[model samples]
Target: MNENLFAPFITPSIMGITTLPIIIMFPCLILSTPKRWIPNRIQTLQMWLIRLITKQMMTMHNKLGRTWTLMLMSLILFIASTNLLGLLPYSFTPTTQLSMNIGMAIPLWMGTVLMGFRNKPKASLAHFLPQGTPTPLIPMLIIIETISLFIQPLALAVRLTANITAGHLLIHLIGSATLALSSISMTVSSITFMILFLLTILEFAVAMIQAYVFTLLVSLYLHDNS
Candidate 1:
């Protein structure tokens, strides 16, 4: 059925109000909390991974950009967790929702833009007008660049939503087909099931990569502005 196929993407509700906030916070509960003084194995590994990722992400930025390491790392972890958790049966993927993605994208993207303007107004404005442009094309180029600048956040939101949605839909379709074919041809059904298993593994990787890509793009934007 339609309900079963679409279930993974549908936001749950109780008494007509959405439960998206609960779903979004579920990942935080799953993360191991750090202890004071004596750290457990999980906490130690978590700290090490955090430091490694932060160091690599901040390598391109100056000291000012490094200040955002915490925010960027948090963003990536939250996204990656939500994505992977959604793979659980009967769970919804918040990143597949365009509204949620846009809400996250706009504020973060705007913060970077505003930071650029506040810290280096001349350099920020200079992005709209490339150097060595012919005088006649300057106005046209400025207009094009200006549009592209404003579209970055929208692009980020759409990109995340589309990729997540596509993967979920494909999995749902293949899973349904695998079930339906079981009654017809056992061999074909088995092959389809194997494909489904591989696709699931691929999706797991995609979820993590998309989160990293989103965070990396934000860091690149920060670097440009900084």
Candidate 2:
């Protein structure tokens, strides 16, 4: 009912707490785990996607990265599922919220950084300062790198939030225009509807790609740390 572009993003609270918990867990309820060797269609598709994502990470020869395959897989699935489901009429997209995105980003990013430090303290510390740095500029470089390191999680959060929010807004605007036009001119509305249809399809692809990109970057961060 709210005409605000962000109205859908506002999490409803029935008992003081926000609605994301339910929305976040919704996918797991419907999609069963792919545990059986001879799997059903859903399981088969799940396994295929997991394998595809794993193979993509392995392309960088990140054997350590494989250790996080499960976490990474779950992350991708959660994000992808939420994004797609949001496209359905009257559905809310938790990923569109910066707070929600940041919540997901910070923990995962912190875990990867901590893992790297725990596994190899010296090597992890080495990343703070590049080799062959000029002695005079060492302090400046370290400060810059430190800031950049801390910015990783925020960057991840913003990237996902921006893409999802922008795509949804564009789709919403176009859809609204199509509806408004329909009352004025049938011919123009028909053409606009066709455009809206195509845009929706494109938005679907964007939803999936944004999820993949979010997971892929996390993998890369994990790889670097590992």
Candidate 3:
């Protein structure tokens, strides 16, 4: 029972073939096209969502930062799709894995930092020490700022992993309880099932919100550097 309860979080494999890549690519399939002059409802909605997200993400960015529109938009869509897909029955949530999240966060985060250093070395270094810092606290402030800078990516990974994991675990626990109680007390089981239903709805919103938050933070970081 315990194993079954935690089974959803496990990275699934069949004959040593991992499903992570397949799940990640599933979202992109929705965006496929066959050269139609006028898009249907689904295609039109998808295009509208893409444009809306792109506009909001680029709002705070400069002309230089606008170059990242495609990358950032793709990221948000991928993450949003992955999170929504995980809510499906018998599906695995890849974002719940810290390694996967960290793997993504580090490289992208580092790229922005590297871009800053390459293009604006003085400005990037200047971030370590604010203007008019006290003489005695300058060294300590630099150390603190440096540590904070490195922690950003780590925080991003942990935040995504922890939120998704917590939501999945809660849903699992409540669902299991609902099933167990159903045999003993129909009334209590019904109430528990209702709660589970509501929680599932909340999780759906959480999934989208987290994806947006992740992409928004990355865009803010890019704006800072660019």
lDDT of 1 by residue, 1-226 (tens): 2456666677899999999999999998999986588889988998898888888889999999989998999999999999999998978889999999999889989999999999999999999999999999999999999999999999999999889889999999999899999999999999999999999999999999999999999999999988
The best candidate in terms of lDDT: 1
What C-alpha lDDT values do all the predictions have?
A: 0.92, 0.87, 0.90
List TM-scores for all candidates, in order: 0.95, 0.91, 0.95
The window of 10 residues in a row where model 3 has the poorest summed lDDT is 1-10
lDDT of 1 at 83: 97
lDDT of 2 at 206: 91
Give, for candidate 2, the lowest lDDT window spanning 10 residues. Answer: 57-66
Compared with the true structure, the alpha-carbon lDDT of candidate 2 equals 0.87
Alpha-carbon deviation at 79 in model 2, angstroms: 0.4
Rank candidates, TM-score, best first: 1, 3, 2
lDDT of candidate 1 at residue 97, scale 0 to 100 = 93
RMSD of every candidate to native, in Å, equals 1.4, 2.1, 1.4
